[model samples]
Target: MNGDWLLRGRDGRLSVYQSSGDAVLCRVERAPGGPWDEPRKVGGEQRLLPVLAVGQGADRYAHLVAWRPTVQGEAGLVHSTHFRARLAALDWNPVGHPNKKGDRTGTPAVAVDAEGRAHVFVRNKGGGVSMLAQKEKGGWEPWQDIRGKGVQDGLAAVTGESGRVELYAAVPEGLLYWRQEEPGARPVLKESLKAPVRPGTLYALATSPASTTLYYTGTGGELWAWRPGGEPVALLPSAGHGPVAAVRCELDGHDCTLLAQRSASGRVAFAAYPTELESAGAWWTESGPQLTVDARVSLGTDEDGRVVAATLSPSTGTLLLTRRKDEPGLALEAWRAV
Candidate 1:
């Protein structure tokens, strides 16, 4: 299963924490397209899947929410823990417990708004959404049970320009989207599209308050995108079998959405979707470099305007970083720390 394995730290460094045997191993890079440090054991004797969120302004620390699964006799329980640490610190101090029932459905999703308040969403044992927010001084508030049914595995969230936070999840019938206009506002159920989207990964792109794009994997392994008032568009057929990782980035002087996924054959591939969806022939026809091995691929932009794509080669147990070289258009240069 895929944990929230890749994270871009507050100080432009990239960190990847994955399950190595019975422990969680973490490795950090100096910056985007830079050298990486040695991998160190971080957590012990737990199947830990970590998701990260950074605090804003003066409270600048990396906040991590990880799910720890345990099996006792016939009942399986997943416990959730929150950890916070500075960018340069080696120790991850525990902050609070978000999951009280010790049963979680998927990876937790976090988004900090303009006022530095963090909103965390997780699928509870009742197959509904349970949410919590951060207080002004510190610590988290009590869990608020948002009413929903048949909520799927993955949860994706994005805060728009108007401080409107949106959440997306998959159901058996289609996709369910919820929106909270401001902090302390109730998350209203916006829409439920009756399409055959798989119940795993959902991506929400809030480029502006007026425009937003939602992408997900269809039942047939096709990459599909949906806008506010339009029909679902099949961007790429047979895109992949997993969740799509995307980032809104500037490419060649245009705002584009960069999506990366592992192909069916276990190779890392990426595509670009231009902002002008109605433009003529604007789809990404150019091919991305096909990496030989792939475990779980991720794409993100660093602080120094550099786009870094990483994939874990399961065979060699190497986390490969590919820095985009834009001298003669788009190209990739591989880097690995000794």
Candidate 2:
């Protein structure tokens, strides 16, 4: 449904609001895949930004992360939690809590592997990047510094078809990747790409399931793609002036498209490439009329191969949803009327 918004809490609480701003659904849980038992109010006077990720399963579970402010002027810390639909639970359990001093940590990006392990990537205020993982039997693992120093962007995780966990982070120097074959072992640096980087800047990265091609946008607004044996190919010709967000998904069962959003004017764009054209060395073609959208749009896909774009209205602070049409010309249909 377009315009309908879902808000999640740091403690793994979920509240679904109707298009008319009515609270229609709510739940709480200890973990995403869990037997949820507790329920409580999401206490806070200030607005909290909720980031959620669907786990790797046929019946996907939603994991949430958020940052809250403390009573003092200092910003509250980041927290991790999860929820699932089967149990109809909405309470969020804190996998990890923030430091008591409360110096302002940012929200975390979450991912769950095939084994149901949770991986969190967080950017500390001091410009350091750390990753935390939770094993099945073991509790929270010690936070590992992915980027020892410098600001990071475009952190993402995807469970490869081979069952290996792939993590990507874009730093000031370039893009960095890490992989782990099994638990209790360090994640090895699989690859790194040297490219122009900028601190406090955001870039989008996604790997094709079929080809494992890593795609990203530079600070200069140019789109680039990297494969195993091939050089990085520049997809977009002209550069723009703002951050880029992208999601990789199949289109019409034939084309693999990278749906990206430009910040300069809040326009949604698409870069469609034939999945069968993986080794053909074909260039990425861009197409879009640049629709007006809220600045905070999140890109995702549904089970039926439909692209879903969610954003919160800056003015009314309402959530909006839009879906890409299943037609042949790469059109988009706004399910939620702005």
Candidate 3:
């Protein structure tokens, strides 16, 4: 995949590594010189979803919760906060200390709104899920319980054009969604999916810009999508394990969906979906060639809706990124060969 890759912080600054196998391609750093004032080491045993939020201007910030082994016994918790050069100048800060009762074994995911406020979600060891949100006026809010006795597998949060923040969590019971109209207001549960049962894995979620349509790949190797006032539809039934990476944007003035996945043979693959289709029966045209990378691939998108693919190089063990383009169809654009 062709995308920009930069060392997140100054050298030797402990950072969170989001890698493909052994290759650490993208590093997430906490904001330095803020309330913390020190570089926080972020890795030990728990995987971290380094949540990043970019403002309307050039400012950006990232927050992640990680666990470190206790000095004398088991594990301790810490939240790593990093502010981009632009966001640091804006004085965006990490809210409060890490939640002591948070799950020290699993990765914690977070979401940020347009105002630079953050909403953190994690699954605790006791099978309880909690949410920690930051308000615009500053200071940390108390942890709120969302569900009990189930895992919060993944979270996808988006701020709508109306300035409302919506959070969707993939829990064992089903897909749970919540929304908040303003700060200090409790998030109202909006919807839930109970059919076509899903297994407990981190499923990827994405939303269309023009509508409230949500898309995700279930644990059962099926591609599922749902929108407000619509029934859930299975898009691709045979698409296999791991969450599908998707990006939504307007193409030719019509909303489009770009999804990528790994084949059973470990090759990378991609498919495009048109918004006009109402059923999952539409055909998906393949775009890229079988990848040669050794590590599993993870994908994301830029603000402009370009697909960014990251994978670890098997030969040199370095992270590689490439962008996908289409002349009339999907094509591989520039690439950073590792």
lDDT of 2 by residue, 1-338 (tens): 21112333334333332211211222333453233333223322334434333233222444444444445665532333334332434433444433334544654556566666767666665666666777678667776765534546445555555545666667678866677757434466667777875432343233554335555666676656656345766666323443344555766666565545444545444456654244444333333334345344456555455666655444454444566787865577753632
Model 3 lDDT, full chain set? 0.49
List, residue by residue over 1-338, the lDDT tens digit for candidate 1: 33335566556666775545544566877554467777766533445544333222223333445554444422122222223212333334333333464444556776656566667777777888887776768766677877678988777766665666677888899888888856657577778888998777577766655656777888887778877566878877645676777767777887777777777655666677576363322233323344454466677666666677777755567776776786644566654422
True-structure RMSD, every candidate: 4.3, 7.4, 7.5
Q: Sorted by lDDT, highest first, which candidate order results? A: 1, 3, 2
Pick by TM-score: 2 or 3, better one:
3
Per-model C-alpha lDDT, please?
0.61, 0.49, 0.49
Which segments of model 1 are wrong by more than 4 Å? 1-7, 19-24, 41-61, 69-102, 276-294, 313-316, 334-338
Evaluated with TM-score, which candidate comes out highest?
1
Q: Can you tell me which runs of candidate 2 are displaced by over 4 Å?
A: 1-59, 70-82, 85-90, 95-102, 105-107, 124-128, 198-213, 227-230, 237-248, 252-255, 276-294
Give the RMSD in angstroms, all C-alphas superposed, for model 1: 4.3
The TM-score between candidate 1 and the true structure equals 0.79
What is candidate 1's CA lDDT for residue 136?
A: 65
